[model samples]
Every structure is written in structure tokens, then in C-alpha cells.
Target: MTRCRLCGSAALVSVVDLGATPPCESFLAADQLDEPEPAYPLHLRVCTDCWLAQIPPLITPEETFTQYAYFSSYSTSWVEHARTFVADAVQRVGLGPDAFVVEVASNDGYLLKHVVDRGIRCLGIEPSVNVGAAARDAGVPTLTAFLDPATGSDVRAEHGPADLVVANNVYAHIPDVVGFTRGLRALVADDGWVSIEVQHLLTLIEENQYDTIYHEHFQYYTVASATRALAAGGLALVDVELLPTHGGSIRLWARPAEAAGEPSRGVADVLAREKAAGLQELSGYTEFSARVAKVRRDLLRFLIEVAERGETVVGYGAPGKGNTLLNHCGIRPDLLPYTVDRNPYKHGRFTPGTRIPILPPEQIAADRPDYVLVLPWNLRAELVEQLSFVHDWGGRLVFPIPELSIVEVAS
Candidate 1:
């Protein structure tokens, strides 16, 4: 971690230290509760040299993604987003029946199913065996492997170069940013497009979205740094699009250097915005730790105040970001009591470090808790709709990121 993972520079500076917490997605089963759980430092640092914000690769992808719990199809909005992206991408690239599409980190075939529906040849390169199986079961051709240079080359050799490679919300997951980019280069045809969606560092900082930091996510990219990372693997960033998903994200349009032309004006505008926000300089990072500390303090104060009033606050989702917030603020089952999720896989499990019990989503309605702390707050609009029934009993929804917001859902 001393040298920058992207540029091999020794000019790393601390952005925020969230202390140590268990890997965010490692939910505990009832039988494994008593056993010792491993934890790793959840600190984020920025490279002055490359401006690549990253954490130490304390936990490897194999430890996290091989048997992953997250399934993309669970989110209604996300699935629609994927569907629309597929439709737009096909039209944007003039993709036809002869074109082949590939999605890296394609979870549960949430996206590729759309391509399949179009009668286009598509494959998913997913690392997790269980999720990959689910993809195959849904009629999507999927390769069960993590994306590295060798794996990318293997997929290219076997299936021929992809006409369109879609990597959404996974650009930050890998430790070797450069190698992953090379893998992306290998999978895509020389003139083919590679679309990557990553949480924008500018948005993460401006919006105070620190809970997204975890071992599974090694790097946070601004368009400036992302451009450099893409170039490291022989891909040139040619365009950029600002997205509303994941709080805020940037969709980078890249291609092999030979075909990559001048970057879009959108890229330049975003770069300017990042610069205006002081992302390139050390000043922007200076107060993030303090802001993060304030968020923790504000949340703990609210949770404690509610506890003292003998009011109950159950959680709405057992998301990884919620675990980070819980562990960082030292919240336990006493404060949260229990959380509920729509995902069946997490039904009987517990949050990693905080050990908050997870129950079926029905439990919230059954218990009629006073306030439901909405984890996965990025889905604020959707969850608010889903939890609108809470209004029947005068229950309010609580969101803990950006700021603590307590909103009443309509009946």
C-alpha cells in the first residue's frame, strides 16, 4: 500500500481511517457466530502522484466475490437501469444480431438477460460460482472467473473479441487497477466500446458518501485519475457520462488507443468540476475525516436519543454500506435491534462486525417499529416507495448518509 497501486508512486496520503471492520458482506450464520471473525483496516488514502484514491488490498477478491451474496436482480430500479443501458448501448453502437456483448462482474445475469432477449450473442464474466450458475440458469452464457489479463485473453481467444464490453459499478473493486484495465482491453475489439460505471470520487466526497469505502472496493476514481488508470491497460478514455446511480457515478466510454479519439466535452467538464472541488490538490481531502467524524457523531447521537426515549429503530436493509456505518459508529443490536432485507440469502444472517440480526422484510411490518433506518440509502427513492406502508402505523424512514434524514412515508 506504500506505493500507489495504479502509478507505483510513494506519495499516498490519508483521506479517512474508518478503523478496522469485518469485510462488509461477510454475514455471520447462526452456527459461526461464536467463532472468531477476521477484520481488516478500512482506511482510504489518496495518491498525490496519480490522484487515485484507494485502500490497502488487505482482503483479496477471492475472499469476497467467489461466493458472493449480492445479486443485482434484487433491485427493481437497477434492473431497469441495466435494461435501459442495454437498449441504449445497442442503439448507440449500432449493435446488431452479429455483435457480441460481454459484461464483466455480471451478477445474476441481471443485465445480460436483456441482451439475450435481443437475440444477440452475449457472455458474462463473473467470479462468483453461485451467481454465475444463477446467470446460466437464466439462459445467459457466463464464464465463472475473475477478470484479469489472462482471463480476459482467455475469454477473447475462446469467444472472439466483444463488440461491446459493459463493466458497471466494478471499476473500483479490484486491487490491480492496471491489470483489470488490460483485461478489459483484451476482451474488447480494437474499435469496440468498453463502458465502465464507477462511483465518482467528486460525488463521494461532495455528497459525504464515505460508507461505500470497504475492503472490497480498493480504489475511488475521479475522471482525471480514471483516465490515467484506463491508459495503463492500453485503453483510452474517449467519453464520459454523469450518472445518478450509486448516489453519483461516471460512465466512462473507452476503446483501444488506436480507435480512441479526443475525449468528449463531458469528460473535460467533469475534470474541471473535480478540479474546482479541489480533488486534485490535498486541500479537498483535508476536511473529509472531520466531516466523516461529524456524521458518525450525529448518527450515534440520534440513535442514542431514540434509545433513551424507548423508541425502536429497525433497519430497512442489511447492505454493506450499512455495516460500515454500524461498525464505524459502534452501533450494535441494542441500538438497531434488528434489520430486514428482501434478499433471502441474508434473512437468517447477521451484520459482519456489528452483529445486528437480519430478518425477513415482513418483520418490519410485523413488529411495527417506530423508525426504520434505511440502509442502502442510495436507493432512497425506491426504498421510500417500498417502505411507504410504514406510514400506516406512523413510522418514519431514517437515512444515515450525506446526513441523517427522517422522512415520513405517505400512506
Candidate 2:
């Protein structure tokens, strides 16, 4: 058995094996579709010691993130999520024009643009060349480097200690998660806080969001696991908030251990809740694989039945999780003819393994397919509102995860 990335223990328990899939964000061009594509194993294991669910890093961050097709600004809902956070963080930290804000993995300046608008100094560390260029164009000072201990030290020296460090949805992307957290501690001022947002492991299991598993996301965190990682870096979690974004996520506020005061009651409440759910033990991780298998079976059966009836199907949103679900289920253009994404970078390309043609959102109105499978179920509400016109043509919406079902559009 492979050792746990967090605690380095040999007791990594099986959670689920999604088989092999191409890098979830590696969308392909038409010319490249016929060529051989590499697929890596999508197996998940939970560390019995730390209770952190994780997958082996089959691919490096350079291979997975540097040339990503995803642009956060494309998702209006996600950008709004960033805006709300920036507003709250500014107030909570009492940030002003003189204060500096640094965001690790700040994609396309989607969040930092707001910080700059308020005249606050901000720096973004983005590894992706294309997305970083876009962020620079948007007037957010961006550095094109992955943030590890050394790079974090350099950034801290160059930009000064940050009053607020934002690592939204990025904690899972690092294989050296401890080093990444160390970087956060190294960069933030002694009394400053770091905000980390990650998809909650409890929601992943209970909601059957198995699609969130891929090579890019090396580790999944429970509150306990996250606390351990932060504590190892001499950071203390001061507060926690459950967010509706990313299926269900936890936004943890942490401070340097030396300066951290008594943590809010929310911390103890969340930890106790996780313990009640058995996350502190191995038994909670068991039976997840069986539940995942059932989802795969039920989904395949639904798609097969629909295809047999000659019903037309197309997909909405080409998020990374969509690629994982599509590749794992072995669904191709035959099952899903084409998928539409608002992000232009993905348009005119094909999904990595499944090779479903990616189109513009207007394709939905032009084709008016019988069913529009909403692949990114986490943003179901936003997608439903955006694609309301589907109801005009008697088209229905399908959400594949947590259970595949047709969404009943409001009249």
C-alpha cells in the first residue's frame, strides 16, 4: 500500500477506483482526437491516520495546470463567489489601500481584480501561462510560478508579507500539500490570516460527488485533516464556514499559531460533527466504493435506456469533473453528441478521453436537443437559470451525480 501523503502512514484504505481517465482538464483539438491519449488511474485512498482522502499524483502540476483550458471568469457564479469572499475578507481583515493581498492559484484575476479595484495591493501566483497572461491583462499583478516553500519565500520577500492569503479551491491541487501550507504560513504576516476553501470530504461521500476525483486534485480534506495540515505548518484554524460552492466546501480561516487566539465555537462544532460521522476512523471510508459502483450502474442504465428510445442528448458545462464522469462511465459522442461551455478556450476542441465536441452555449438553442445533461451538478442552480430557454422547446435537464434525475423546471 502507498503511504498517506499527509501522515506518511502505510494504512491507506481503499475508497473508490474510477479506473483510468485522461487529465480531466486536457481538452483535445479535432486533429488530436484520433491520436493516442494517455489515461491515468483514478484510484482514491483515505489515510487512516489523518482521515484525508487522496489520490496518487500520477501527473505533475506543470502537466496538468500550466496550460489549462479552464478560465474562472467564464463561470459567472464562481466569479460572484470570489467577489463575495473578497468583500467579506476585506471587512474581516480590516484591509485598506496599504494592505497587501496575495492569492495562490489565482486564476485569471477573477478575485484579485476586485481587490485592485478597491485600491488594495494584491499579487497572484498562477502557474498557467495563458490564464496568468489574462490576469495580467486584467491589471492584477501575477507571477507565473507554483507556490512551494522556496517560491513562497521569494514572493514574500518581493511583495512583502500578506495581510490576507487566499487559496480558494487550490489546497487539493498540490501533491506536496504540507509544503503548500508551509508556503502560506511563510507568506502571511504574523497576525494575518489565510483563507482556504476546499470541497468537504463528508459531502463528497454522502453526495456521491465521485466525479470530483481526478489527477489534478491530489488530496481531499475533512476539517480534521485540514487542521492537522495547518497545524504542521504552525498555523491554527480560527474559524470555519460551510459554503454552497463546489458541491459543499469549507472556508477555513487560519492564523499563525503563535498569534492565534481561542478559536471560535464553529471549529469545535464542526469537529464534533465530523467525529459523529466517524470521519476520525476508517469505518467511515468503507462502503463508499459500493455506493459509487451503484451510481455508475444506475447512470449507465439511464443513458442506455434513453439512447434506446432514440432520445437526443447533449451536455452542459465542460468542467474537469465532467471529464472524469464522462471518461469513467465510458460515455462518448455516441451517448452525448456534444457539450457546450461558456469558456471560449474550450470551444472548437474536444473532451480529452471521450472526445465529445465542445460547442458554444447557443448550440443548445440551435439544436434544441431533447435533454441537456448538466454535467457540473455543483452549479445546477446557475445552469438552470442560464438555460431556462430549454423549457420553451419541451427539453428537460438532467443532473448526473448525487443521483441522475430530470430537473423539474419551474413554470
Model 1 lDDT tens row, 307-354:
999999999888888888999999998898999988999989999988
Per-candidate TM-scores read 0.99, 0.98
- Superposed model 2: Cα runs more than 4 Å off: none
Report the CA-based lDDT of candidate 1 relative to the real structure.
Answer: 0.94
- Please, what is the whole-model Cα lDDT of each candidate in the order they appear? 0.94, 0.90
For model 2, what is the C-alpha lDDT against the true structure? 0.90
Model 2: lowest-lDDT 10 consecutive positions: 402-411
Candidate 1 ranges beyond 4 A from true positions: none
Tens digit of per-residue lDDT, candidate 2, span 19-78 = 988999988988897789999989999888788889998899989888878899988899
